[model samples]
Target: MSEITPDLVRHLGVLARIQLSDAEVERLTGQLDVIVDNIAKVSRVATPEVPATSHPIAMSNVFRPDVVGDMLTSEQVLQNAPDAADGRFRVTAILGEEQ
Candidate 1:
């Protein structure tokens, strides 16, 4: 397995805009080496024959019938509105420009 060098750590630190001390660089290098080795092992086992799947169980569309039900009157719809104007609920202006 290849070891992570101090140069590599320094380069990574620079790219990430992080300033690491000598001790931190040494510690990170060892950790990074182990991580890289583990990733390499995982990559070796990932083959083309293993088909990629998102879920373990089969799924199908579950839908309900689209049917229009009871409708509310205009008075019932605007009953809870704090402010109503011209037979509609009055809301604060959303756009900067006035309509």
Candidate 2:
């Protein structure tokens, strides 16, 4: 027995606010049945004994030790700015918005 029917497809179209013709309804009924059957088959194969995974292989994060480095002062960084104000870079207002 098929789980998807024309009436069910019509109801789904109505819920989704879609205007489906009779031909479309009939076509979708068969297509949706195949999709639902595939999902059921996959579900039956996914037993609790098998673990779920996002990837086929295990993964680990690599990290390096943090070290202090030479840095530029605020005044030295601001020297390259086209516009600066209040110790920060200033940009023109966008879309008539101001902060």
Candidate 3:
């Protein structure tokens, strides 16, 4: 198991460019020690027989297949538009072009 000493915590604070007081350093040392010990316990339980995975159980894509179906005709599509021209929906020019 790795030891989380006050000195190690102070060094990490310097590397991270954060200012930590003596009290904070002492407090963090105990917390980091617990985290390291917990990770060590997990490593001991892991076995070669178990396949490594990001999740606890098997996962797969649950999405439906992408397939093209019947499409809307130009007249049917333009029926709901406020304006239509040349078998297409017409809108005001955004770039100041006179129509």
The C-alpha stretches of model 1 lying farther than 4 A from their native spots are: 57-73
Candidate 3: list runs displaced more than 4 Å.
69-99
What TM-score does candidate 2 get on C-alpha atoms?
Answer: 0.70
Clashing pairs in 1: none
**Count of clashing pairs, candidate 3:** 0
lDDT of each prediction vs. the true structure? 0.91, 0.94, 0.91
Q: What is the lDDT of residue 61 in candidate 2?
A: 75
Clashes of 1: 0
Give one digit per residue, the lDDT tens place, for model 3 in 1-99.
558999999999999998999999989999999999998888987889867789888899999999999999998899999999999889977875564
Q: Count the clashes in each prediction.
A: 0, 0, 0
Model 2 lDDT tens row, 9-79: 99999999999999999999999999999999989999999899998989877787799899999999999
Q: Which ten residues in a row have the lowest lDDT in candidate 3?
A: 90-99
Full candidate order by TM-score, most accurate first: 2, 1, 3
Which clashing pairs does model 3 show? none
Candidate 2: lDDT over CA atoms?
A: 0.94
Highest-scoring model, TM-score: 2
